[model samples]
Target: MTDMVEAPSGSGWKLLAPVRRAEGWLASVPAALPLLALRLALAVPFYKSGLTKWDGFLQLSGGAQFLFGQEFKLHVFGAQYPYPFPTAAAYGAGTAEIVLPVLLVLGLGTRFAALALLIMTAVIQITVPEGWANFHLPWAAMALTLAVYGGGALSLDRLIGLGREKM
Candidate 1:
């Protein structure tokens, strides 16, 4: 057989040489960009929600109080109990919403942060099934991306070379 081979035509393997080149070029893109995008996309919602969780930026109780008392039906504890005490769950969720997003943005503990947000996303879905299509589902999808793919090359985890791990 000859050492040279000809590219086949009409089967789409020959005509798309430029497209193939573009694909090859795309392969060099750093993982950091997508990971950073995931972080930002995931961060804004939680930050806004966290901001809403408090009536005031300075006070920690206002918004969470209203949510636990009226809006959210966390049902974490037995609903039958004299005190449903959604407050505890609310506190956990709120704290996580605020803290996790920041951590994610900084890529500080990307996998761990993604994990916490993933759990919170689950809780949010279970707590408010009505908002599934509106918010929870989309949030969960992004959180899942972060969880499975991890912080990517742009994250602090990557910067610090955390756990000597690869994303």
Candidate 2:
């Protein structure tokens, strides 16, 4: 013998099965998906800029020097940065471009990486408001998203249990 039970229409419990299953499935996904995308989105332009500027790591080609010497300036800073300063700035920017992306992709220290990139994006926007239409705006948007939302479900932060939301 067996017992049978019936539920009223639109009780809503039926709809929960798939949702619960999906939620459970989603929990296993690595936290790096969105973060990786944002990382790549953020990294590419700077990587290309780095590449076109120099063939070797940290080696500034003539075009890079020309750009730093002539085009790059801190208009908002209201002060002229002297020699060795531009190279310093360039090195910092280039290093961030290369290194931060890897960290973001790895989902390690994601918030910090996103914050760094966000700062860089803000500086670019401020330094060249004219270029906002092209690169700076998009970079800022992506960086800000990662800065807020973090590395998502597929990441080292989540894997090692560091980035998980606190109870």
Candidate 3:
């Protein structure tokens, strides 16, 4: 038998060859890389915000307190309302900003952490409705993406088989 194989007898194959190669190349890319990038992208803003909220370990900054208390307001149906227990809200948001971002970057409890961030994003949108177009919208989208797709193969969740979705 001849080792040579005949090519498909159509010019359509010529046109499709490059497209098929590009598809194959894309398919070869690791899912983990993009997931890691997403995690990092989501983490940076939160981590920076968290850093500003603390003067030292476990100590919330005065500026953070002031913002949550005096500056930030929840806008609801054309009415503005003060945060209930503003100091507590500051502390809670501060802690979450730090902890959740760390968790997201590490890909540990990624979905839970992402969900928590998503909730925080909603609260932030209410607090600063004008930011929706710029900050809140992108953050909400990223958080929701991570919450759904989860940390990929590079994550601790994947290594430990903690929250893997079945194929």
Task: Sort all candidates by TM-score, best to worst.
Answer: 3, 1, 2
**lDDT by residue for model 3 (1-167), tens:** 12166668699767977887888788788878878898999899988988999999988899999998899999999999999999999899999999999999999999999999999999989998889998988888989888988888888898888757432
Top candidate (lDDT)? 3
Ten-residue region with minimum lDDT total, candidate 3: 1-10
For model 2, residues 1-167, the per-residue Cα lDDT tens digits are 11165544674966866776788778766555556778677767766665676658678677667666677766566664433477767667767777787787787877788889888877776667688878877888887877777776677887887676321
lDDT of 1: 0.75
Candidate 2 residue runs with Cα over 4 Å from true position? 1-36, 77-84, 165-167
User: What lDDT score is found at residue 8 in candidate 3?
Assistant: 81
Q: Per-residue lDDT tens digits of candidate 1, residues 9-72?
A: 6768756777768887787677778778988999999988887766555456766877676776
lDDT of each: 0.75, 0.71, 0.88
TM-scores for candidates 1 onward, in order: 0.77, 0.68, 0.85
Inter-residue clash pairs, candidate 1: 32-154
How displaced is residue 157 in candidate 3, in Å? 0.7
Which is the better candidate, 1 or 2, if ranked by lDDT? 1
Candidate 1 residue 62 C-alpha distance from true site, Å: 3.2
Clashes of each: 1, 8, 0
Instruction: State model 2's lDDT.
Output: 0.71
